[model samples]
Target: MSALLGCGIVLLAGCGSMPVTGDVKAVDASQPGDSQVQVYAVAPREGAAPSEVVDGFLESMTSDDPDFRTTRKYLTEEAARTWKPSEGTTVLAKAPNRNGPSLHDKERRSTETSYRLTGEKVAAVDEESSYQPLAPTDYSQTLHLVRGNGADGKGEWRIDIVPDGLVLGQSDFKRLYRSVNKYYFASGRTNGQSALVADPVYVRNRTDPVTRMDTATQTVRTLLAGPTNWLRPVVDSRFPTGTALRKGVTSLAPDDQNVLKVPLNQKADKAGQGACRMMAAQVLFTLRDLTSARVEQVELESDRGRLCSLGADEAEEFASDNGSGAPDSQYFIDDKGRVLRIPGNTRGSGDPEPVTGPLGTGTVVMSAVGVARDEQHAAAVSANHQNLYVASMVADGELAGPAVTSRAKKAEDRLSRPSWDGRGDLWVADRDPDSRRLLRLANGEGKPQEVTVPSLDGGRIEEVRMSADGVRIALLLSKDGLMTLKIGRIERHGPESAPKVSVEDLRQAAPQLTDVTALSWSGRSRLVVVGKEDGGVQQVRYVQADGSTSSSGVLPGVNQVQAVAAADDELLPLMAETVDDGIVKLSPGDNWQTVLKGGMSLVYPG
Candidate 1:
């Protein structure tokens, strides 16, 4: 690796008054087109000053060196042996500013010097590879250097005490790592069916420094490791306890036939054929977006031999209805306050037709609507926004009386838009000041049950959108004139006869947006949000469920966006209701075009 650094190198003298008495050059931090363009670590020259050693170590932390052997070269033997880069990662807004090398023990003329590293922390990645974006906060740490004996028999400055794990700038972190989703089954499935839930995590884009594995291999290993801490409460992994990849296996690739063969340890050898196939499904779903070569099949192997195999087509049995299968038809309320639909896969403002229901026939005026994942049932909020009604979309019939009603005097404080989960349950938020609560109806019909949200912290839920997977929910919370988007884990407890649902651990999913107006789940781990920064113009963009932002998140500018809707299938055009343009749709690679000149409240089935 050091030899590779010698080629295409640019060397410059160290600057500043920190006593950097060695060759220092700027690291190539440009965003590359692919993982092939990587920055390798340069070994510390002999007798490097304290500042140079500290700078070199920080630079090496961002490199693609497989094991960080070069990173340890700047540390003393004790520090090197004690350092653990895999413990966690601290991401900063920019490279940390170094100050000092002030003499300690001035009275005794000690050889030790200390440097203060400070920066603004932006996010953190735990050992489990879970990324959590945090409110920017001040970060401070100290690196102590001491004189040590060198192989040349001269005094050398090396880091003696350092912080555990890697500390990287946000730009470098993004360049070195990529987000990937691991699959797990939703727990407590009373029926004979199973659904895979996505657990997104970050991993090295190239080879992992600590694991010494390629991207695909690392992702599979993480899948076997189980779900993340926040998601573990509601999901289960098919992999048995202690199951792991076969020892000494560091790379995984698809054959010419696009089949990936994964060898597992003895723990998996005992799994039955059914369990083995489920395990294969988890791997296939997790790696679907990672590998350069498409994987058509997954064959699981054990110490003894092949245990079982699953083809890509067969893996659909475990697919989650949330974003799987065909594209969903877009729905909205027309100018006449009746529900209308745009057929799925239609392009350029295709003919809009009325749905086959009372809500569509104007039997009862409607303001908002949510269609079930199956497209069999639809829930509509009355024009007054005080009454909630559920009607069949397949069978034409008169709508029954209000299934759920809100008594808030002001229309703005009435019921919110309805959302249906993949489990065939309907969810809505009652914004009534005196009776503020989230309600859910089993099968879109029984008595409305109040879903507990214990972590609201005096804030009110302005809107609610349930992920199709049924294990997560997106909430728009309003407090002090600001609306923030938060993602909460949906936990179901007790027995199937009487289940208790609660939305817990509410965390900011779009902290960068000062005020969020509307949002919808666009993919497994992504959301299309219509919001803006402080004092900035209203705009549309995509946000990961984890709250991290990417350069490509921002969409082409749309004017006066009052509402936004995105389908789980990303191929469908993004629909939104704007003041300037009544309703507009943005296709995959095209600009926004008017869909309906008079429609409002556009949305896709949740």
Candidate 2:
């Protein structure tokens, strides 16, 4: 009668874990105490596994005593019942012991072996450790994992693990790593080996492991050898996945490591909207390569009911690399917290150019950098801000975007920000040297509408705007410091004819000192003007066309202002203000409201 005693591996050739599909069951048929493993000397180990290994590593963090029984003959085996032995038995199925002498490897590795006193079927496995780092974080080190049978089987090797430190921070990864630290065969379904899609084109069996994209020829190469599959680059260069932090990421690799700066997924469909998405995601999981979670571990969990989707940490694989990269993986998600696959990500069949629908490109365009935001639909000036711009961000009191239109200048570049005019015409604002011009990109004559507001140097344009009725245009004027608001019935004036309103007494300066700056059209005749009070006390006043005004009271502490717009109606009535690059929304409340968050613009186009 043949009884299964224990099991373990001799590791004649293969380097780590069970074959991609082979059996890694820790089942050895050997008897108690006499089992031993024999590995041929193909190389010597340069790095040692660790002292006390698993239990010791975890025990330090807990109150329980965690010491392994060195003399017990219980081998970690299969068909036996459990993974960790029953706590008391020498029916001894032993895992391969990492004593000394191994292949040269810098990757953190653990070898688990299982075998009995007399057996042939050995179960063994080898695993590499992972890490994590804080954003703008960059760290690199060479780790050596040495393992063998007796006291002399040691080998040396090198492996690169970026984001290697991430695993170090996660309690889950550490738990998972130690649960099966000492490598054994078949980590079971949930615990089994995971395959990572290391590069952009590695999707089929026709290719091996180390696949390469030739920078020289722009061609791709695949590495083929024993057990063959390598994704090595022809010149070994990489492109950044998003916005590249030139100075920040330099520390991640040797000065020689090529910092990848691939054409941003949609570099400038409209977000920061010109250059590209930073090589690193400002949120989480910026870098996209093996150093991070590799393809298999970066899943974008979509939230179906919500506008934005949630992404899997360093665990789930991304479905594709189209519109949303990084954690914006979810086109949408279901209520169960599971990722609901979106349309473009067709089961990841590898579609390169997913068509861009009406939503502009799903690229990071202009992120609100100021402390101003509007209620879901706040009506903005309907003009692209160009006068105050360093970048398309509200740095001081300015906002900006790169020049993308035909009138673009290296300096005063003009990007077309087309806001519709209830009519089929597109409206755009251009800030020329002395002209605050508004253009109709499409006109009644089938040409772009170009309306330039004559310079305020002659007389300041306290406020210039199109009425909600779409029938008239109102240009509030405060020639000097006093407010001399004016109204114009633009539809009757024709496009080329400029509307001018003058109140002789209104143009004259006054000692009252109303330094009006921001204007909100509350109604065709009523307006909200924010300015200094009698003693420079900041206040927002509601002014009626009849020249009578109501006090909205002092604006509290905030003084700096760029743009302010009111929401359309009562139900969705909203207000937005640009503080810096951040847009803050003024939630309706008592007299005045303090800024509660960063920002997102909500323009009520209707």
Candidate 3:
């Protein structure tokens, strides 16, 4: 790292006299005021005095010695004279410096000190402490710039010296260097500390300590971006650190809201209009918790680097020519873009899906499933890229509930399964998208109620799914937060001895629960609930999908995590999402971590 530090660096000059105004404030012996005034200006380049001004200023900042020292003398005819303190000025760099003049990293670059000048009115001029570096890159020193007896007397402006970070980001860095170059040549580009005040009058004399900043910029740029950097970087290295600097996070909602996701087809087909062309992955419209609609043509192949539309709107007419022999697995979202209701997949814009369902960054995983489009729950069984999967709700690899959508005509025997029970269970309801609707399956010899959700856009019924307990069913409705045959329902409350095994019973049991926000069943007996408290952060809790939590520690860490959702025992064991270059794992053990640097780790959930 020492090799990164340059040797020709000069120290502060022009201390005994004022660098600017040509007249350093004398300790006025016959004064009416209480203090003195001191002013420092920009230094000049090498060779000539004006050129050394900037160097002098820098030297003052870097030097252990005072860049300028003047005595406050008092003597009036030897009879009685007075000298008092007034205003004192100081400068500082606001933020901590991540990089300094030298570092081991080859990519590191050096930056000049930025100064924040301020003043204070005092009774007397006092010596100030030496300046200190805020971090590795910044330095700050405060001094009472003046001491005077005037009506206006107090610390004045608070200024900051802009550091390399802001300076480098500016687009005109190169041009500024050129203007300073001309000033340097006339000064003979000497190698000594001096001053150069830009204040108009001092323009003629190169001897004056202060001058223009244009000279320093040119010299520095030449040394840094020039051939000299090849042999030994003329620029100083940045500060050293245990880790690299980082940027803040941006909301995922904003990312999806602005970016439109569409599916593209390469091969031409004669099946339908715009059949093989990359049609707009139409944004499905939904009334939040109500109905949904759109005209998107998406498929499970979305997981294969494509974004599949779950809405009936987009895929309504997306029929592939049967003569071409399209596979049974290939299907599209209706003309609408919708998905299983996942907790955060609220399509406030009427297109209900994950705030992140576009699918092209390749950051999503097989675990990167699109959530169902519901306010209470989020669900997606497959992706464009994930391998085929079987759900506890989906037995025998067959979707026994809602029939899959197709572009071709339907057959007479569309196929059917017994409702909840072996007999004809019949309590099926596909009304609301955000609520629960039960489909009754008889225990014995009875006909089960059929499940038929209406087309959200007044178009057609698309898809549906049932809860594992076989009590609740989910339907894909239109974008409106309402529905006709609303599936949203409260589980019936039963007696305490024979408690009703439904959500309503459990919710009714809570004396203070008010309402439930996050609801999920842990197997059959336990249920998890997460909701915000009136006065505190959100509460992470659970009871029975059908039972109330009366026990202590129901919600251990309130607000410990944001965006909590139900992750069954099955989804927690492996890596769930890959973001950037890191993997976010959802451990069933109730823990998570990310990979970065040599690896990465997320904030721990205590």
Among these predictions, the greatest TM-score belongs to 1
| Per-residue C-alpha lDDT of model 1 across residues 1-606, encoded as one tens digit per residue | 456444533222221323343432223243432344467777788767778888888878877766888889888889999999999999887767776766767652345788888888989999999989887899889998988755665578889999998998777888888888999998888776588888989899878988899999999999999999989999998788999999998999999999999999999977899988999999999988889998999999989999899999999889767342556888889878899988876743678899997888987889999988888788999999999999988888888999999999999999999998888889999999999989999889889989999889888998899887789999999999999999999999999656998999998875768899999988677889999888999889998877777767899998989988888777888888899888998999999998889987788888
Native-to-model Cα distance after best TM-score fit, residue 568 in candidate 3, in Å: 5.8
lDDT of each: 0.84, 0.26, 0.23
Q: What's the TM for model 3?
A: 0.21
- Models 1 onward score TM values of 0.94, 0.29, 0.21
Rank candidates, lDDT, best first. 1, 2, 3
Lowest lDDT 10-residue stretch of candidate 3? 197-206
Q: For model 3, what is the error of residue 201's alpha carbon versus the real structure, in angstroms, after optimal superposition?
A: 94
Candidate 2 vs candidate 3: the lDDT winner is 2
Model 2: residues with Cα > 4 Å off, grouped in runs: 1-364, 367-426, 434-436, 441-446, 452-464, 475-486, 493-513, 533-535, 552-559, 578-596, 600-602
Give, for candidate 1, the lowest lDDT window spanning 10 residues.
Answer: 9-18
Better structure of 1 and 3 per TM-score: 1
lDDT per residue as tens, model 2, 332-389: 1112211122222222112223112211122223311111111011112212333211
How big is the RMSD of model 2?
29.2
Residues 1-606 of candidate 3 have per-residue lDDT tens digits of: 233223322222333222334422221111111112112222322222221222233333322222122211111111112222111212221111121112223442121122222222111111111111111132333211111222554221111221111111001111111111110000111222111100000011111111121222222222222211111211111111121111121111112233223222222121132321212211121111111222232231222354232434533222111111211011111112222221211111112222223221122222212121111111222233112111221112222222121122222112111112101122323233333233333221233323332323441222222333233333323233321111222232344222233311111212234333333333222334444433445454544322223334254343233222233222322221123434233434454554221111111100
